[model samples]
Target: MEPVVQFDHVTKNYGSQVAVDDLNLSIEAGKFVTLLGPSGCGKSTSLRMLGGFEMPTSGRILLSGKDVTRVPPNKRNVNIVFQDYALFPHMNVAKNIAFGLELKGLDNKSIHRRVSELLELVQLQDYANRLPNELSGGQRQRVALMRALAPDPDVLLLDEPLSALDAKLRQQMQIELKAIQEKTGKTFMFVTHDQEEALTMSDTIVVMNNGRIEQMGDPSTLYGRPGSVFVANFIGETNLLRSTVLGAEGNLTALDWNGITIKADQGGLSPKAGEHLYVVLRPESIHCSATEPTSGNRIKGKIRQRVFKGNHTSLAVEVGDGAVLNTLVHPGDVAQLAGDDIWVGWKPETATVIPDRHAHR
Candidate 1:
């Protein structure tokens, strides 16, 4: 299937500095694609370029295979829900939603029908006559979304639409927003720095850094098997161990991790003997116990700190070489390992070999 939106060799620059460097990406129709990265990582800039709010310095952008690089924001078949709910305070909910439909010259009857439907879609039918200030933050955000969807644009661009709400409201909106997208079947290009939001709502996540595409894949693929150290550290909690490659045989690569020889699955990474590698071990993958496990890779560490986090207890263990390995222990098992000395073990396949970013230096 062809992509609904395409960024072909796109680059955006501000004077001498580069904001987006040669970004090439494709967004399939009806898929919720998220641009996820930190501040100054160019996620918002890329989204702005697609929305025609900003122009590319050097490449063409296509919307449904049509070149729309120079198309103005108003001309493009897209609508944006800004981070701040940009609703007219004076206009009530109904008027706010009907604004775009009126601008498009739709008949009064049709506008009312569409507005009523949108109000119901966002569960705000009773809020039609109420002004923006009369509603809560989440309710106002829903109105903003209804306003954007008023015209039935081909793509909906969300720029951190849930960032303003509190934790509980933001979580609630995440579920609602995803359901709304599925119900409307519209292509969504969302931008966010929150990894959890991207992981929860996106069909495809494009992880960016320094204006470049670091990785792009489904949430599970990006989380379970990160392509780079930066991605591993950014997406979730994991232990990044600096190890030297002791040997490589078949799919298994042996590494000397702080005096212990542990094996890791290469996952297609070709590491030479004596070369340095960053081994990624997720905290959840490590099992801690009072006694040593009879099999698999085992290590002895001293538990420095234990944090009780409702569902599970997080233990910070100082294994060796001044490196602290984080392990998540179940609530039931936390009592037995309250002492300092503990045994941590994981399967060889649970550990993945990633390229050592510092190896080149």
Candidate 2:
């Protein structure tokens, strides 16, 4: 299948600062692709470029195999749902949804048909006569989605559409948005700084940093096997351990961290005899015990703090070598309290080796 949207070596600059730098990505038809990164990472800039609100300094953007880099926003078959919803206060819900069609000079009868269909699509048919001010945050968001979808754009671009809502409403809208996308089957390209939102809604996630594509993959793949230190650290909480590659035999690579030896996969990259490496261990993967395990790489640590987060408990342990490991254990299995000594261990496969980047160290 051909990619519906493609960015080839894309770069965007403002004055002397580069916002998006040499980004290359592809999104398949009807796929929900998210541009995810923290603020100033250029995810929003990339979205704007795709929306035709901004032009790339270099490279091209292809929509359905046609170059739309120079095309104006309205001329292209794309619509955006802004964070603020961008609905006019004077326009009722029905008129707001019909606004796009009206600008295109559609007849009143056709506009009513399209708007009605969209209102039902977003499950806001009953709110058609209501004003934007009268609607709740989630309801207003639905209105925004209806307006964007009323045009039947080939792609829908969402710019943090749920960011303005309260936390509970944001969570509710995330579910609603995903359901709407699946029901409509339209290509959706969303931009968000929230990693959890991207992971939950995206068919494919593009992790960007410093205006460049850091990693792109399915949520599980990106989360479980982050290609870089930045990706691993950014995607979730992890214990980043600085170590040195000791030796490798077959699939197992031995690493030495402050004289503490541990084994991991070879990671496909050959390491020098004393080459520095970093290990990323997820909190859930680390097993904490009151006593040291007979097998595996076990380390003793004093629990610095504990946080009970409903389902599980998070323990911050201060191990040797100036390293702190945050481990999550089941509430039922948690044995030690703050200031108590405990042993943490994990299987060789649990820890993945990444580049020894300074940010991770």
Best by TM-score: 1
For each candidate in turn, the TM-score is 0.98, 0.94
- Where is the poorest 10-residue window by lDDT in model 1? 314-323
Tens digits of lDDT, candidate 1, 118-164: 99998899999999999999999999999998898888999999999
Model 2 lDDT per residue over 1-361, tens place: 9988889999999999999999899899898899999999999998889899999999999988999999999899889999899999999999998989998899999999988888887778889899999999889999999899888888899999989989988888888888989999999999999988988899999999999999899999888878888899889888877789888866767998877888876566776668888887899988999888998779998888888998999989888856789998897787554348899999888777888766346
State the displacement of the C-alpha of residue 162, model 1, in Å, after optimal TM-score superposition: 1.0
| Prediction 2 TM-score vs. true | 0.94
Candidate 2 wrong stretches, greater than 4 Å? 335-339, 357-361
Q: Which model scores highest in lDDT? A: 1
Off by over 4 Å in 1: none
